[model samples]
Target: MKHKQAGLSLIGLLIVAVLLAFVFLIGMRTVPVVTEYFAVKKIIHAIAASNPSMDETTADIRRDFDKRASAEYVDSVTGQDLAVYKHGGQFEIGIEYSRKIPIVANVSLLLEFQTDAKSNGGR
Candidate 1:
């Protein structure tokens, strides 16, 4: 009589464990970038939603961004990093930046984020 293997062997389990660990490490390294991206989106939306600022000057807009940056915990990009544009009679804030994350001795990850915040409820 012949029987099939019922479960994973030691080598099979070890391979699986190693793969899981590699994934976990990559996730750990990327977590901060993901979190900060959302934080940036939130800050942009908040600033864009402020209706009165639609007509505000660039200096005022930058000032508000600086304030929001502190409150929102967005450390990567500053108000000076923002580019303001007027689109379709509404104000838009555009940001383009990149972050480099170290993965290992010779490997790294580069993430680039490009986003715009429009005051007219457009993403």
Candidate 2:
């Protein structure tokens, strides 16, 4: 007589579960930074849109950005790190920053993001 087999043996299921947990751990560690990046971008866009005249000096813009960033709890990048410029009578703001996240012991992840926003222009 012959016997039949089923899908996903106990060992296989355990392995899959472990892999999933590892991935979830990584996600849990990285999600906050990613969301913060988006928040920073949104803030920049909002500032650009609000000051369409592009007459604000770089210092003024940086101060405004610092205020908003602090309110939003953005610590990775600061207003001083921003490249504030005007071109063709339009205001543009750009930021470059890196975040290092620790996954497991002695193993870490490094993420680098570069984002820019223009006055009254879609990012």
Candidate 3:
């Protein structure tokens, strides 16, 4: 007669638990940045959908971005930081920014995010 084993041993379970904990720790540090990007992207989409005139100047765009950024809680970039230009009667708004996520003492992760929005009329 042979007895069969169907469960993970102590060492195997320990390894699995450690791996899960590591993943969770990293996710906790990184999830917020991803969510913030979505918020900024939403604001961009909103502005694009509103059909802002191409004649608006950089200051005008920055002012509008400030209002929307405050409402959306987007602190990463402002209109002044964005690269705004017009191409074929379509406004292009773009930003390149980076986020620092701290995991442990002197250990951190740097993430770069870039997003853009274009006027609907141009499309």
Candidate 4:
């Protein structure tokens, strides 16, 4: 009688390890994007809370949002704009940010996100 042990082959183990490594890398890369998105959301909420007097246009809010985000990430934040609209007495403010993620030389991932908040004259 003879007994033999079976185990994962080198290639099989290597493949599993590579797959795990890839998942970890993707998660790491996504963390910053998620963080930036949340930060933008917070900024939008703050702007809405402040409830700056509604002006003839949304330029002031846009500039203020850009200034805040820019100060937070002077070197990273790019493409700042505002998407604003009003509904009767309520106003909705949307802060948008477009950023480029460098994946390789001259290759980037264009990531953009917007956050919207509504204000009812501080009610």
Best by TM-score: 2
Model 4 misplaced regions, further than 4 Å: 1-6, 74-80, 95-114
Clash tally for model 4: 0
How close is each model in CA RMSD to the real structure?
3.0, 3.0, 2.4, 3.5
Please tell me which predicted candidate would have the highest lDDT against the true structure. Answer: 2
lDDT tens readout by residue for model 3, 1-123: 999979999999999999999899999888888888888888877777776786777678778888999988887788788787877777878788999988889999999988888876543
Q: Which stretches of model 2 miss by more than 4 angstroms?
A: 52-54, 120-123
With a 3 Å backbone cut-off (N, CA, C), the pairs that clash in candidate 4 are none
Clash statistics: count for each candidate: 0, 0, 0, 0
Kindly state the number of residue pairs that clash in model 3.
0
List TM-score per model, in order: 0.86, 0.88, 0.84, 0.71
Order of all candidates by TM-score, from best down to worst? 2, 1, 3, 4
* Local distance difference test, each candidate: 0.83, 0.88, 0.83, 0.72
Cα displacement (angstroms), candidate 3, residue 85, comes to 0.2
Per-residue C-alpha lDDT of model 2 across residues 52-75, encoded as one tens digit per residue: 565567888889989999999999
Candidate 3: where are CA atoms >4 Å away?
121-123
Give the Cα error of residue 52 in candidate 4, in Å.
1.9
The Cα error of candidate 1 at residue 14, in Å, is 1.5
